[model samples]
Target: MSRPSENGLSSETLFFTATWNGDSTRCVARLAPAVEAVPVFPAYDLRAQFEIMRLAREKAGIPAPRTLWFEPDPAPLGTPFFVMERADGQVPPDVMPYTFGGWLHDASPAEQRRLQDASVGILAALHQTAFTAEELAPLGEAGLRAHVAAQRAYYAWAHGRRPIPLLERAFAWLEEHWPDEPGPDVLSWGDARIGNMMFRDFTPVAVLDWEMAAVGPRELDLSWMIFLHRFFQDITTGAGLPGLPGFMRREDVCATYRELTGYEPRDLDFYELYAALRHGIIMARVWQRRIHFGEQPMPDDPDDLVLHRATIEELLAGYEPAS
Candidate 1:
């Protein structure tokens, strides 16, 4: 907490890694409650976020950052924050998008697959991990129901001030085709894309981001794994560049996960749409945040905020978009 660089004034600091001076032991700090400067509905709660990560580390045997300390009061920092020992390794870069070019691109196909398999393997481990009522108490008891409910809430919140019709249609589609019985409810690594993982030597050393972590069917995470990579791949493929083709194909990831956990991934068609819906809602908020910070102007199309607009529509129409 004594890091001078991080002590400077700021309305909100969502996440940053701090290195101790003595031994240079690095730890990540996650601050909560969107600053008034960049408002988003359903402000993140420090306690709930803390519990998720703590439970994942202690109970799930997942490679999560070590939950070091949590400060609820805003006195020490402008907002409530929690610190965890920073997991080592490089995250596939966001700007270049690993699919396009970066360290991942420089690596051989086999090494990239090693990282991809390890990433899915971590997801398998999470799905296979069980939890008692007490361990899951902090996240609420909605179980699988909680997944849809949260997205519905997010859609409503994002549209309250800024309506995106594409998001509306996607939400409606999800509601109509909602699975009656979505198999077994397990711990879903809610934000389950490879982007959330840290890899060293083409292997996931740490799994980051648990704010979206929830208890849901395996499909939620599995579908997200496919959809997110496909999004990036679509971009690169559109540019006529060879993207991360072998990274996270639907069959390959599902097969690897199945091999590890002995559970066949199902209902991915529905879940991928769900993933787009979820990502679309978050993207809308992100654009709203950009507008709030005066960093970017509002676009002509509300769907502009949603990155995979064309893909979402195609999926809704019962067709896989060309990726």
Candidate 2:
């Protein structure tokens, strides 16, 4: 096992990678210590959230990080951090190696179909598994509502400050098209996506990043995944693959989800539109953080800027007049 490297502040508090001793080899662990340094409002106590998720995973028979240790504050290690048993797999979001380019670049329709199936299957299993709402009662309905409101407010503030027309439009759309009946409440992984899961040999090995995990409408999770694909579609055409692997068509995703879970999909258009707006808002905040911290230069990616702008326009276009 690789010896533990000397621990110290190296990067942003929410995320950092470090090598640590494993049973037989050095294992690299990514740490999301807390939100102590971020400018956003605290959603939940990071330590507590991790504990809840860990317990939830065990109860549901889901493969998640086994929490080795954790603390509420920066006492033991000068920061709130948790250690978990690292699993072996590749995160789909990272840059794919050249060797992977063959299948990635020239993927047959059949192969693409398989990838989509796996993504849907994993999410279905996640939502279908049992985990009592009572266990998550600490984050009450009000708390969940506040979480969504906070996100909306944060984006609106960003839009007002920057006066991005597209963002303003997206906000308007979201307000108009909010779901009428958002289905049964379930544990929603706030940021559900293929990028968040680790896969080995094209199969999911572990689902990571439960920092934003909470109890909410089941459709919230589904919408997030569907919107993620749409977000990517906005950025590029068929010329070159982006950093993340493209899954099957969005229709296929929704169909597969319905087949696996026995719940008919609803308001896909509204949800997808909401997803795009949500993502744009989140990215805006991320950009704001980078500028506030002077961590790096403001993004210069024209594609990203346009995509966010376009998402806003799309949102506005989908807005319905109030009765």
Candidate 2 local distance difference test against the native: 0.60
lDDT of each residue in 1-323, candidate 2, tens digit only: 24333222222233334445643422333344355466433343556556665764687655676666665566655655665666666554423332134443355656556665776776677778776666676555523355567666656565455655555555566666667776666776767876667666566677766655667666667888777765655454443656334454567777898899998777766666666766776666656666668876655542243336666565555565446
Which pairs of residues clash in candidate 1, taking residues 3 or more apart in a chain or in different chains?
none
Question: Any idea how many clashes model 2 has?
Answer: 0
- Runs off by more than 4 Å, candidate 1: 1-24, 319-323
Best by lDDT: 1
How do all models score by TM-score? 0.89, 0.76
Residue 49, model 1: lDDT of 71
The RMSD of every model to the true structure, in order and in angstroms, is 4.0, 5.6
- List where candidate 2 sits over 4 angstroms from the true fold: 1-44, 94-108, 142-147, 156-165, 238-246, 293-307, 318-323
